[model samples]
Target chain A: MAKRGMLIVLSGPSGVGKGTVRKAIFDQGGNDFQYSISMTTRKPREGEVNGEDYYFVSKEEFEHNIETGQMLEYAKYVDNYYGTPLKYVNETLDRGKDVFLEIEVNGALQVRKRLPEGVFVFLTPPDLMKLKQRIINRGTEDMETINKRMTKAVEEIRMMQDYDFAVVNDKVENAVESIKTIIKSERFRVERVFPEYEEMLGDK
Target chain B: MAKRGMLIVLSGPSGVGKGTVRKAIFDQGGNDFQYSISMTTRKPREGEVNGEDYYFVSKEEFEHNIETGQMLEYAKYVDNYYGTPLKYVNETLDRGKDVFLEIEVNGALQVRKRLPEGVFVFLTPPDLMKLKQRIINRGTEDMETINKRMTKAVEEIRMMQDYDFAVVNDKVENAVESIKTIIKSERFRVERVFPEYEEMLGDK
Candidate 1:
């Protein structure tokens, strides 16, 4: 029997280099990884592909999916609705491909509530100052915004207890390696690997 | 503050190559690993060192430690007292070095019951046939003894649900790699790594 894939929920505060680490994993050919494309009511920015970046949909369609229970977990931020579609994750895992969900803390909590078996990993910056510096380097947000983000980052770090693993994103390559090791090792977990043992026992 | 070390309990049926895998890890410089030497009543082999191979002690001393709860876990196997001393494991972990216990299934279960936080790993051969063949290859055990061992091996594999991770000892190097990965990832566990986050947060 083929082993089923794992659902890895990756969450981090903004400016924690989650994007860069995730990209590095893909660049290094993260084996059997399928990033879950989220569905959003927000309009896609210029050069953003509809299905690639997000499943860009109208507010009516998004709300309909939420009502129909198609959304695994969804939340409204500001004026836009963002959520993970259940079908994509389920189908990917059915194909024996690991699904990576890069969502915020709140959405990750929701996923945890819904899919308790999912592996929850929280990425954190090396320190608050480094996080602040990274946000400043972006040049898109003002000082006030950066300060607010730093405070929120601390609060998020406080919620680390809810996660299964905490990864310090000091270096993108190292962080990616850690995550890959985690996933590879998780495959050996008794709960994940036990079902196939019945036939493989080879004694009967 | 430095991270506290982990207690990794490695257990396997006879002829599963547990010893080979363990030695391979050490040969590759398992820098943080400290094998927990068990106190035994049985006489050591001619070339076996006293403290290195086994802390060969008198039956009276081994029984006294068990009665005083100084032994973490003990078993009387074939009139020989074998048990892990609580002091060595505790002191080594206090020094921030991971302690590895290579014990049989029953002893591993006792450790799990005593220290629920310890990581339990079960090792098995690639198949029952291979396991029986390995037992026969020992050349010391007679046919009847080998048959009994094979039956016991099947029974032991059934108890694998009590373990956290299961490694198939198909190839010694691959088995060692799997165990190393498990320990490395277990270090990132939130419960183990969260306390350090408070100081790393930089606000406290």
Candidate 2:
């Protein structure tokens, strides 16, 4: 029997470069997993391909899929529905291919509740001071908005306690390498690989 | 306060090449952990440096250490005492240095009882058939001894349930790399790293 692939979830607070690190993972190649192409009712932006960026569908189709439980998880933003398709993810994992999901923290929270076995990684900045500095450097915002954003960032970071691993994004390269190490070592976890070895024991 | 270093314990069924894989890890360098130097009452063989090979000690001294709870775990083998000194391990970890222990499964079982936080890694042969073949290739062992050894090997493998990771020694290089990945990834485990990140949260 083929081994079920792991669900790799990458998420963190805003401005922590989760997207950049996720992009770097795929761009560097040698990855054995498939990127999640979310299904969305939102129309494609300039240069965005339908199947590449998302499985663009009409709102009616999206709502029908959600009704039928075809959507793994979904959310509506600006009157547009966006979600991961349950069928694609299940088929890929059933076929022994991993699926990678790089989503916002709120999306990850929903997925976390739904999938108990996911490898949820929380990417963090070196320290809160750096994050505060980054927020302040975006000088276009007024002081009130800046304070609000900092408060929100702190709240998001507190969510790291829910994760299985916390990786500091001190350097993109270092964070990427640490993530790769996590993926590689996770395969050797005894619970994950014990069945194969047990088979070899042969009636013992 | 310094972060406490992890204790990495590597063990496996006989002939699974635990020692070879461990040597490959340390020999390749870039390792931040100290190799376990067991204190033993056995006389050193040729070319064996006292402290480098084993911390050669008198039987009285070894017994006294054990009686005082200085020994993490100990076992008697052929009229000699072999055990890990708990004081050295604690001091090194207090200084934030990791320690690697390569031992037989019985020794691993003892350490597992003494140190719950240690990373217990079980090295496995690719399969039992390969192990039987190697046993047969030895030719000097009688059929009865061969069967007994196989049964013992099976018994040892059952202890893998106590381990956190199981690395297949399919190839020395691959096993070495996997061990390195395990070591690297362990550093990011939330429970090990959460305290520092929590401190950064301050009054939150």
Candidate 3:
């Protein structure tokens, strides 16, 4: 039988370049793994595909999945629903391909409860001052919104201790290298690699 | 203040090439750390140093250390004594240098209890057949002793699950690379690098 693929939860504070690091890891060749595409009740944005970008569905369909427990975890945001689908994640892992879920701290924690063996990685900035600069450089939010995000960032960074690994995003290449190292090391964990060995020795 | 260094325990069945991989790591210029030299009452062989190799000591001295709680763990083997010194390990760690302790599974477990943060890595041969070949290649034992060592090897391999990481010693270079990856990833643990951030976030 094929070995099971690892489930990885990637979480970080807003504007810490988590998306960029995730892109770099994929760009450096992690195509064997699946990037989980979440489902949402919100309308598809311009150029976004219904099933590829997200499994965009109506409110009724989303509520139905939630009721049937098909959703791994879901949250309502600004009158729209967003969630991870359990079916796709299970299918992807069963196919012997690892799955990456880029999620917020809360969502990652919820997933951790369901998948205890899942690897949770927290991406962090070098320091708080650098984080503030990166957030303002985006120019996507006013000072009030920026302040709120900074507050949330502090809270998220605190939750980093709950993570299995932390990659400091001072440099994108360095952060990607750290993440790659973690993935490789996790693959060598005895519980993940030696179940057959355990059984064979048990019989002896 | 300088950050604290991690304690790393390296354990494997005899002749799994743990020594060779460790030497390669040091030879490849990764010696910013210290290797913990264990103390023993066993007589020094030819060319072995008093302090540099094993801390060759008298039986009384070994027993005295055990009574005084200076040793981390002690074992009586073939009418001789051996144990790890807690002082040297703590001093090396306090100097912000990672320490590698080459030990058996039992000794590794004892150290782990004392240093709960230590990383435990179990190295293994590719298979039992290869392990027997490696032991025979050492040319230090007769057939009877070889069989005895092989039996011990199987028993040691069974305890691999207690390790945090395991590397199959199929090739020297590959095993060294795997160990390097484990060290790099371990250094990125959130608690090790981001304690202040965790405290400031008020989530601790």
Best by DockQ: 2
**Which digits, one per residue and each the tens of the lDDT, describe model 1 over residues A1-204?**
356688998888767877788778777883777898889999889999988889999999999999999998889999999999999998888877889998888888899998888899989777753564566476776778777766776787787889999988878878988999899889899898776665545533
The ten-residue window of minimal lDDT in model 3 chain A covers: A195-204
Cα distance off (Å), candidate 2, residue B100: 1.3
True contacts kept of each: 0.69, 0.63, 0.63
State TM-scores per candidate.
0.85, 0.87, 0.82
lDDT of 3 by residue, A1-204 (tens): 556789988888767888788878887884567788889999988999987878999999999999998987788889998889999998888877899888766778789889989988998767663554556475766777667767876776667878988887889998887887888888888888776465444443
Model 2, docking class:
acceptable
Q: For residues A142-169, what per-residue lDDT tens digits would candidate 2 score against the true structure?
A: 8787677577656756788888898999
Candidate 2 C-alpha lDDT tens digits along B1-204? 778899999989768898789889888998889997889999999999998989999999999998998988788989999888988888988888999988878888888888888898999777654655656476776878778767876776677788999988889999998988999999988888877655545523
Query: Can you rank all candidates by DockQ, best first?
Result: 2, 1, 3
What candidate 1 gets wrong by more than 4 Å, as runs, is: A128-154, A199-204, B1-3, B128-154, B198-203
Best by lDDT: 2
- lDDT digits (tens) for residues B1-204 of candidate 3: 456789988888767888788878777984566888889999899999988879999999889899999998768879998889989998888888899888866788788788889889999877753554455476766778666756775676677877888888888899988988888888878768776464444421
| lDDT of the structure predicted as candidate 1 | 0.83
TM-score winner between candidates 1 and 3? 1
Interface RMSDs of the predictions, in order, are 4.4, 3.3, 4.4
How high is the CA lDDT of each candidate model?
Answer: 0.83, 0.84, 0.80
lDDT for position A124 in model 2: 79
